[model samples]
Target chain A: MKARVFIRLKSEVLDPQGQAIESALKNLNENNIKNIRQGKLIEMDIEAKNVEEAKKSIENITVKLLANTVIEDYKIEIE
Target chain B: MKARVFIRLKSEVLDPQGQAIESALKNLNENNIKNIRQGKLIEMDIEAKNVEEAKKSIENITVKLLANTVIEDYKIEIE
Candidate 1:
């Protein structure tokens, strides 16, 4: 199975990296944009019996290694 | 409009960060995973008349600032 994990900072958290990107865009005259947020996308192939198993496995991996639970949230997709 | 940009390394390029994560996962007994790739996900709100305009604007922003076309590929989604 192929699994995807989308890890994003929680909305309430400050994202300085994202703010930097937004400022850069503004400097380049992309004035229409706002509230820019940045995150991580992880894609991998996993050996699993079914989609459910893959999702579960990936979820475990995400919580343990991919995301900082105190400030980041993650969503998983399996295919 | 809401725009999402997914920026990923080209398949032929090396991703040392992803490899490190994969190694760590293996050390933690996640033996079922392989071919791990990491990418960036950027989300923002933009002022546009319609979805088409939103996509075009985001595409321009992505090409100009978000992605390094030489070694990375990017996809834009607008909603």
Candidate 2:
């Protein structure tokens, strides 16, 4: 089974990296850019017997290892 | 307007960070994990008058500034 996890920073958290990218874009004449927030996308392939099992494993992995729950939120999609 | 960009490394590329994370997951007893690949998601808010303009600007930004076209592929979604 294949699973994808999209990890994003909480709205309240300050993203310096995003700000840095935003500044870089502005310097490149992308003046229409307003705000930029950066996150992570993790793609995993697991040896599972079924889709339900895969989803469960992915959810646990996402919460425990993939994302910093304190400041980031993650969504899981299984295929 | 809001746009999201998903940047992923090409399959031929070796991702050391993904390997490191995979090792960490194994140490945590995630034995079912087979393979892991990591990527980036960039969320941007731009000052565009229409969806077509937003999509065009996002595509340009993605190609020129967000992704290194040599070894990475990026997909853009505008809303």
Candidate 3:
């Protein structure tokens, strides 16, 4: 199975990278966007025996390393 | 309209962040993943007059600042 992980900054935290990009857009004279936020997406292909095992493995991946618990939240999709 | 920009490292380049995460997963004893790649996703809400204008605006953003053409490729999705 393949798992896709989307980890995004928590709502309460400041996204400096996104802000910098927005400022660069302003400098480029493109003032059409009202807002933008940036985050990370991780795609993984696992050689698990079954879907349940794949899900369980990815759950541990997210909790341990893929997603930072302090400043981010994650969503996992299986295919 | 909402435009999502997904910028990812070019396939030729090594993704150190992804490698580190995968190794960390191995250390955590979850050994089912075959491969992983990480990238950035930027979500933008634009209040443009029309779709074409919004697209043009984002194209400029991507070409000029959002994506580094040398080592990354980007995909734009509008909603």
Candidate 4:
């Protein structure tokens, strides 16, 4: 099975990197863009028997290693 | 409108950061995971007339700034 994990900073956290990108875009004339935020996407193959198993394992992996629960949130998808 | 841009390295490119993560996972007893890859996800609001226009603008921004065309590919989604 293939899994994808999307990890993003919590809504209340300040993202300096995202702000930097927003400013850069503004300089490039992308005035219509707003509230720019950046996140991480991790794709991996898992040796699981079914979608449920893959999702469960990926969720565990995400909570333990992929995301910092204190400041970030994560979602997992299995295919 | 809201937009998301996913930027990933080309298949042929090597991802050392992903490799490091994979090894770390192995050390942490996640032996079932393999072929790990990492990418970027950008989320933002777009002041466009419609989804089509938002997607088009995002594509342009992705190609010009978010992704390195020579080594990465990007997908844009507008909602």
- Badly placed stretches (over 4 Å) of model 2 are none
Query: Which candidate gets the maximum lDDT versus the true structure?
Result: 1
Give me the TM-scores for chain A across all models, comma-separated.
0.96, 0.92, 0.88, 0.94
Residue-wise C-alpha lDDT for candidate 3, range B17-55, written one tens digit per residue: 888888887788767786688999888888788888888
What TM-score against the true fold does each predicted structure earn?
Answer: 0.98, 0.92, 0.89, 0.97
> Best candidate, TM-score-wise?
1
TM-score for the B chain of model 4? 0.95
Instruction: Write candidate 1's Cα lDDT for A13-39 as tens digits.
Output: 999989999999988898999999999
Lowest lDDT block of 10, candidate 2 chain A: A26-35
Is candidate 2 or 3 superior in TM-score? 2
Order of quality (DockQ): 1, 4, 3, 2
DockQ (C-alpha based) per candidate is: 0.93, 0.79, 0.82, 0.90
Instruction: State what share of the real interface contacts each candidate retains.
Output: 0.90, 0.90, 0.94, 0.88
Better of 2 and 3 by DockQ: 3
lDDT of 2 at A38: 97
Enumerate clash totals for all models, in the order shown. 0, 0, 0, 0
Residue B15 error, candidate 1, Å: 0.6
How big is the positional error of residue B53 in model 1, measured in Å on the Cα after superposition?
Answer: 1.2
Q: Can you give the lDDT of residue A36 in candidate 2?
A: 89
lDDT tens readout by residue for model 3, A18-50: 888888888777777856789998887898888
lDDT of 4 by residue, A1-79 (tens): 8889999999999999899889999878999999999999999999988888888888888888889999999999887
Tens-digit lDDT track of model 2 for B1-79:
8889999999999998899889988878988886788999999888888988888888887888889999999988887
Which wins on DockQ, candidate 1 or candidate 3?
Answer: 1
